[model samples]
Target: MEIVEFGSDDSGLVARFVDVSNAVRRHDAPWQHLQTVHAATGMLRHGWDGEPAVPFLATHGGDDVAAGEWHVGNYDNLHIAWLTVDVHPAFRRRGHGTELLEALVDRTRSAGRTSVGGDGWDNELSRSFAARHGFEQKAVEVNRRQLLAEVDPALVDRLHAEAAAVAASYELVRCPARTPDDQLPVMAEMVSAINDAPIDDLDIEDEVFNAERVRAYEEAHAGRGITLHRLVARHRETGELAGQTVIGVDRERPHLGNQHDTSVVRAHRGHRLGLLLKTGMLQWLREVEPQIEEIDTWNAESNNFMIDVNEMLGYRIVGRALAFQKSLA
Candidate 1:
């Protein structure tokens, strides 16, 4: 088998990789995974807006075998943003996946990066592959979904009112545009604090969420088809970006139509801005995509605060995953 550098930005290559990756994803993740992949891939390719992305291809027996992707982002450690191998259903036991993975390891060492990162669901093959790669299990990214059709409107309304009453001075807007480019510095610092906010057992090395990375995320992750429903909490007295929550809705969901990211700035933690933004985002979801049956989200397993807010909003844990990693050196 020959391992090669094909690069992730090649549209044809990306499409081909998606063909296999999506197939495996179908067998593994919910339909929303495709949308997230589509969105992230687009961002990852948006003029390299994300961290540097490297793609490697594997081929043998005159057939396309697999591809691996690495994204060098804000983490002090160079991370393997994605790695997927498609052993033709016919080629499963022939050890093609193992060979490609070994090759990826060699490449990482040559590149001078410290580690690799990727997430996988709680499945036997996934867990086994991670273990075989010299990776230890890390945090579980809890995936949750709430069906709009079954939502308790009275409860939602009550929470909405209560959250709003407490956060009365702030206004809600639906796009990242409301977040000014100038405030990128403050936005970066605030997000950095939150990124550095308490989480259990993550090998995070530095607080790297900054202005450039935030905008790069915009160009790379939250692109056009996916709209960012961002509600910023401005200090009533200071008018600074004290708190914010952002949700993403992809019109592409097969059954359930939206997914969201909700966060509240640390300083505004006690004022229930988290509650306000979540309730506001739910309200927006209800009005705009009433057809959307549910929305999914992920949070650190140890994140009691966000998890509690989600629980109050009727979100339930649907599945769990491990973010596995290994040091390159």
Candidate 2:
């Protein structure tokens, strides 16, 4: 078996990697729940404008058989994000995962990064691999899903009414497609508020979630998969952006939903804008994306406010995962 590093807008090979990855874990997610070819290629080519991510494809027999999508960032915290390996069921235990991982870790050490971090579901393949590599289970992330089919329709209506009444001083607006170029700067500022939320064991550098990185996130991952609707609420008279919620649909198979983000600006708190924005967006999602069967979201376990809101909305815990780390030294 041969391991070859592929880079610089290798769209076709990247698509092949995604295909193999999807095929292997095909049933794990409700829908495909992944970026389309264009989105994946965009990341591979110039994610964060060459900020130290090198996606690799493992190939043999004139066919690209295995793939790894990983990032070698400062993590702005001296770590990594979403570091997962993909080996076709036909090619498991063939050592491709190890090769690709080692390559990135080696690169991180050489680049002066201080640590390596990763996360995976509380499933065998993930936990076993982490144990074998001496990575400890440092923190766990719990995932919860609320079945729209089981949720009380009347409750959704009442929540909408109460929330709308409280939020009446603001206007709920969904920016169709991307925000205009003129709005990008404020969008950046508004988006930065997200970092204010909680991340328990992940050593995320709080202040590093700045305008630059926020815009990078908005551009890279925001508007993909299904209808990417970023619902923002602006003060009615002042026209100042007050709160926001983003709901996503699985474009290929519309029945699945992902709550990308829901937040209220510091000043916008106390008004229940968080609840208002979320329920409003949920209503929009239900009506327009009715086929959506499941909507999943996560927050730090200690985040009582958001979790309470989610509980009220009927989101039930589904699975748990740990974000683990190892020092490169």
Candidate 3:
């Protein structure tokens, strides 16, 4: 087996990578959308927040067998690297996955990272593989999806109205596409509220967010051809941003949407802002992105607050994933 790193410019290799990814998705997560070449290229080039991962393709006997990437954060979690390994369904049990993982671990250690983390669908195969590799399960996450066709407008209206009444002191502000330059500062501050979410014993640090980081995030999404629809709640009197919810709609696949982050500042909790923000987003998307069919989101199993809100909005559990970590030290 041979492993070689490839850049975004190498369209041939990128397409091969997407092929393996789609193959794995079909076998492992048939309900999930397939990956497109354009989206994969953008991800390889722009990454999540302008920090692209180092992607590698493994080939055996002139046939592509596995794909992997190692991602390290520049702003926070500086001591750890996140890894992903996807083996072609037809090529599994041939030691391709393990070999690719070994290469990723080597790169992680060479990057001076003390810990490495990876996540996979909850299954005996995934669990035993991690355990055999000396990794410990640290957290569990539930993936829930909302199908627009099944949502009740009457329910959404009632919830939004109830939340609005309770949060009468605040107003919802619609921010479509990219955030304005003037709002980056406040957006950064409010985005940091995600730090309050449950980590479930994962060895990580609070992500540092600022104006620059916010800009980078918007740009990265734009580069991936995703239109960002963000709804923020602001205090009526003080005009401070209290909470926000963001959804990204894919341009290439207009029927698909992703739930980004929904958070409220610690001082502003207990006002039903979470419900207000999410319900407001649903209403706003109805008008702007009626083409969207399904939206997916993930939450730590321990985050009952957010899960309750999601469930109330008709989000149903689609799958569960396990996060595993290994200390390189």
Candidate 4:
């Protein structure tokens, strides 16, 4: 097996890598939504979340058989490297994945990193690989999906009403398709609230969020043809941003949307702002993107508060995934 490192500019090879990765995901977890090559390429080329990617392709018989991408976090977690290795289902069990993983870990160690992190299905094969490779199970992330068609619009309205009753001091701001300039700074603060999410045993740093990072994130999504719908709660008294939630809908796949980053700052947690933000966006989507059928979200299993909110909003667990990490001793 020949492992060749592919550069960010190699769009052809990166597209092939995305093909292989999507194939693996579909075959391994059919319930999960497949990612777009455009998004993967954008992340690799543009470093979404401020982490540059190093992609490797494994070639055999003059064909790109398997692929892996290693990303070293630069924002705040420089000591950790995250890698995803996907061997085409047809090429699995031939030692390609093992080779790619070993090479990724070696590269991370060479870069003076302390640990390597990756996520995988909770299936037996993935669990066994992590066990055999000395990767410690750090956390379990639950992937949940909500069918919008089955969602009762009245439920959202009722939730909105209930939240409104208690959250009277907070005003909800709805930003469709783009973030307003006036809200950019507070949006950065809300983005930083994600750092409060349970990281479990994963050795990583808190992401630094500012207007610049928000713009880069917006650009990356736009490059992938994804439109974002956001709802942010602000305290009417102090004019402080309390909480926010975002839903991303792909133009190519209008039937599916992604639930990303629903967070409430520490000072504003007890006011049911999370429910307000989520339901507010759901109501907006019902009006704007009625074609969206389902929205998927992932949360750490330990996040009972968020899970409770999701459960209340009709999101059910579809699959279990694991985050694994290995320390370079």
Candidate 5:
């Protein structure tokens, strides 16, 4: 077996890594959206958007069969090293995955981190691998898919009507792929609402959002051939943003859209803003990107509120992911 660390902007190596990664995704969850080489390259180029990442390649029997990206950041739980690994289906049971994971753990320990964390599809192999390696289940995430073709037109109308009736004191604002300058600060602050989501025992911290970080995301999404559509409910009289939601459609995968984030400020709760924001965004997609066939979202299993909203919007569980962590100390 051979292990090589990828260098910056190495498109060829990144493409190969993506090939192996996507192969794993296809075998594990065919219903999931496929990632393009462009998107993979963008992630490699940014090193997970500048959080310090080291990607590893594993070759067994002289062929690349597995890959892993290990990351750490001061912004997150600094003592934990975040890891993501993908092993081609054909390479499973050959000890390639185990060897590569050991290398990742060794590197994490050398970096002075107290723990290593990762997420994987909640399958027999995934669960057994984590358990064998002494990693404990930290959280579970549901992968929900909404088929746009299955969406009922009448339901759409009803949701829009119901949201409008309750949101009489607020107005909905829609924006294209980029954030406007004036709303940058509010948009940045509004993103913090995601911190309220339950993470269970995962060693994670609330993310810091600011104008620069939001701009970085915009640039990354644009580079990855993804277009972001945003909707925000604004207070009618004060013009303050009461809630916001975003949907992203990748040009490379036109049939798949991603439900990014939807959050209603604490003070704005109970106005059905979550529903109003989501339904309004869905309506916008219906008009502008009618070709989108399905949208996928991940929610913590314990987040009943968002889960209920997704269920009402016709999303159903297609798969699951489990977060696992191992103590290095």
Candidate 6:
């Protein structure tokens, strides 16, 4: 068995990595959309918030059998490294997964990270794998996809109206594909509201956000051929940013959309901003992106508030994922 590190520039190896990943996805989670080489290439080159994970591909007897990655945040959670190991379905039970995991753990420790974390679909196979590695389940996250075609237009109108009535003191602002130069400051501050979301027992720190990070996020998404639509709620009198929701539609797969974030500032709670932001986004997408068939989102099972709003918006569970962590110490 041999393991080799790769970057986005290595087109040949990256293609092999995508093949292994798509195979794993098809076997483990067929409900997921298959990955495209173009999207995978962009992700490897420009990761979330501009911090790309280090990728490794493993081969045995000249056949690629598995892939792995190790990622750490540049702004926060400096002591932990998030890792992933995916063995081709046909290659499972051959010790490829264990070999790849051991290599990734070594890299994590070499990076001075004291803890490593990863997530997989909540299934007996995944659970047993984590348990065998001495990793503990830290949290469970539900993947929900809202089918736009199944949504009732009247129900959306009614919900939007009801939320608008409660949030009468605020107005929605439609941001462009890229946030304007002036709003980046407050937008950075507003993005931090996501920290309030529950993490369960995960040992991680609140992500640090700033104007630069916001720009990086937008750039990263753009690089992946994703069109971003952001809607922000502002106080009518004080002109402050009260809350916001962001959704991204892939230009390559225009029929599918993704829910990025929907957060309400702490002081602006109880005004139904979460509902307003999400419902308003749906209405806007109908006008601008009428071809979108579904929008996918993930939320911690412990996040009842967000879950309630998602349920009200017609989002249904597709699957649940289990997060697992182990201390290298």
Candidate 2: residue 54 Cα off by (Å): 3.2
- Minimal lDDT window, size 10, model 5: 43-52
List the lowest-lDDT window of 10 residues for candidate 1: 77-86
Query: Would you list the clashing residue pairs of candidate 3?
Result: none
- Model 1 per-residue lDDT tens digits across residues 1-329: 88777654566666666665655666666544552446435644552345645666667876667666655554544444345444544456677888987776666667666676676778887788889878888777888887777788778888989988877776665655335788788877656546634545656565477687778766654453555566666776776676667666554553454444456666666778888878877787677656667778778888888889888988888788887877765
Q: Output the TM-score of candidate 3.
A: 0.98
Number of clashes in model 6? 0
Rank list by TM-score: 6, 3, 4, 5, 1, 2
For candidate 6, what is the TM-score?
0.98
> Candidate 1 at 82: error in angstroms?
6.0
Candidate 4, residues 1-329, lDDT tens digits: the string is 88988765788887788788788888999997776776677667666544567888898887677888888755567788899888899888888889889999988989999888898999898899898899989999999999877788999899989988889999998865567787678788878999999989887778888887888788777766778887889899998888889998888888999998999999988888988888898888888998999999999999999999899989999999999998886
Candidate 2 residue lDDT tens string, 1-329: 57666775676777787777676656344333554676566557656423535677778787676777667654355544446666776766777667777776777677777677777766788787788887777777778898898987789889988988877798888776456767877776676677778776665575454445544555554333445778898999988888788876646656777777777789878888888887887778766777889888877667788888899999988767667777766
Which ranges in model 2 have alpha carbons more than 4 Å from their true place? 7-12, 23-53, 59-66, 73-82, 87-96, 165-169, 207-226, 236-240, 286-291
Q: Rate the local accuracy (lDDT) of all candidates.
A: 0.66, 0.71, 0.93, 0.85, 0.84, 0.93
lDDT of 4 at 47: 67
Candidate 2 is scored at a TM of 0.78
lDDT of 4: 0.85
Q: Candidate 6, residues 1-329: lDDT per residue as tens digits?
A: 89999999999999999999999999999999998888888888889779999999999998999999989888999999999999999989989999999999998899899999999999998999999999999999999999998999889989999999999999999998788778899999999999999999999999999999999999999988889999999999999898889999989999999999889999999999999999899999999999999999999999999999999989999999999999999
